[model samples]
Target: MPVDLVPTPGAGPRVTFTGLGGAELIIGLTGQSRQMSRWALGFILIAAAGTALARRGCGSKVIFIVVVLTVASLLALWLPATTDVANGAFMAGAALVPLYILIALVQRLWNSLFVRNM
Candidate 1:
């Protein structure tokens, strides 16, 4: 499998490959470095707020469930405008269950460290 390196302006070279059906696929080597940082910041902020709320005697389970459901619902509504409407909405809505569980565990961990009265 041979790849072609194409230099990008102000960044490293990206990889270009010929795929099935002779389609050209360009993989950016330097363009997506900051993508995870943005989402990490969002999760950090959410965790901080959730921990603070837990310390203040707020219900962690309820908060996690509500926040996950609200965000997933909003994503479901917003994604349809950008991509395949039905699939986008369905994927976003379907993500609610896993996101809810993951966030619940994170909330519990934060609460365990900050909230002493468990």
Candidate 2:
């Protein structure tokens, strides 16, 4: 069957050209979403970090969470942006989950290495 071979445009803000194949070429991206999700995810990240930091006498877990979340939000901001509000926001938000888990691992390692009582 013939693949849906769409004309891939040159590099720009919108979709990027991947490559040509035997029959059809695939476009890496299609659009850009500069608004909408940006503010939403930004606010959520701020609130989450604020809340994590606000807790009094934060333990190692809290410190780890705050640092991890903040880093995740930062990385999310760096994620490749798509053409749709949903896509950009989704990619940004999705990028944070694994970051949080990594934070947990780092905290555990720190605890074992430094804080023996923890």
Candidate 3:
């Protein structure tokens, strides 16, 4: 199931699930929800940092090792949270590492192909 973070009028962020009965789940309203929300936010920030580092000429080997470790950690957390319908969190967390790498690669290719002084 894919989860979307949608904003509402005069309301906080809302999580909506697609292909899982079309339900809207609101998080961060309570203790556990708030913790989970913080975790998710932290994960996104880490992923973004990793992506930025990779883009700034970090070697592929280093990025791969870091991404692998990140995915592993996410899996460890996801396994316990799986029973609570947090698949979207897991998916987004896992996907961001590779997505950033791909973005860096595309940017590099674009620079090489069109921006080279040659």
Candidate 4:
């Protein structure tokens, strides 16, 4: 790689260190490849499960399932061994409900305010 094309080692960290979550993510990623892999795997599985449930005509139950998963992930925090998986699980489980609601709200508002005559 050309020297100009390759970023300096400190350049990336400098930008990431400016934000709280970015800094933590950068710090957590250092020398923790295994834990990061576990987190990613867990997140993918949890998200897939949620999507599967939603696709199988379990529309109403999806919210309940996500809530349960979120709670379980939170409880998993009590045990150090599960923390990595739980962090990813919690992120997946916790984001769905609010995101769903936000999208629905936006659609509703758009329909009510800007959608043309029906």
Identify the candidate with maximal TM-score. Answer: 4
Among the numbered candidates, top lDDT falls to: 4
- Residue range 1-118, candidate 4, lDDT tens digits: 2223356775645432455454322123334898898788767877787665553443664765667586666667677667777778777777666755666678779989998986
Q: Give per-residue lDDT, candidate 4, residue 43.
A: 78
Model 3 Cα lDDT, one tens digit per residue, 1-118: 4577566788966665569476555553347886676567655655555555554544663665466456656665876543233433344546666776787789889999889686
Taken over the whole model, the C-alpha lDDT of each candidate is 0.52, 0.51, 0.59, 0.66
lDDT, model 3, position 53: 58
Per-prediction TM-score: 0.34, 0.33, 0.38, 0.47
- Backbone clash count for every predicted candidate, in the order shown: 0, 2, 0, 0
lDDT by residue (18-84, candidate 2, tens digit) is 6665545444633235355564655465446444543234364455455655565556567544223
Q: After superposition, how far is residue 67 of candidate 4 from its true place, in Å?
A: 4.6
For model 1, how does the per-residue alpha-carbon lDDT over 23-79 read when each residue is reduced to its tens digit? Answer: 755554433445445445444555554545443333564656476546646664786
Please give the lDDT score at residue 36 for candidate 1.
46
lDDT for 68 in candidate 3 is: 49
The TM-score that candidate 2 achieves is 0.33
Q: How big is the RMSD of model 3?
A: 12.5
Q: Candidates sorted by TM-score, descending order? A: 4, 3, 1, 2
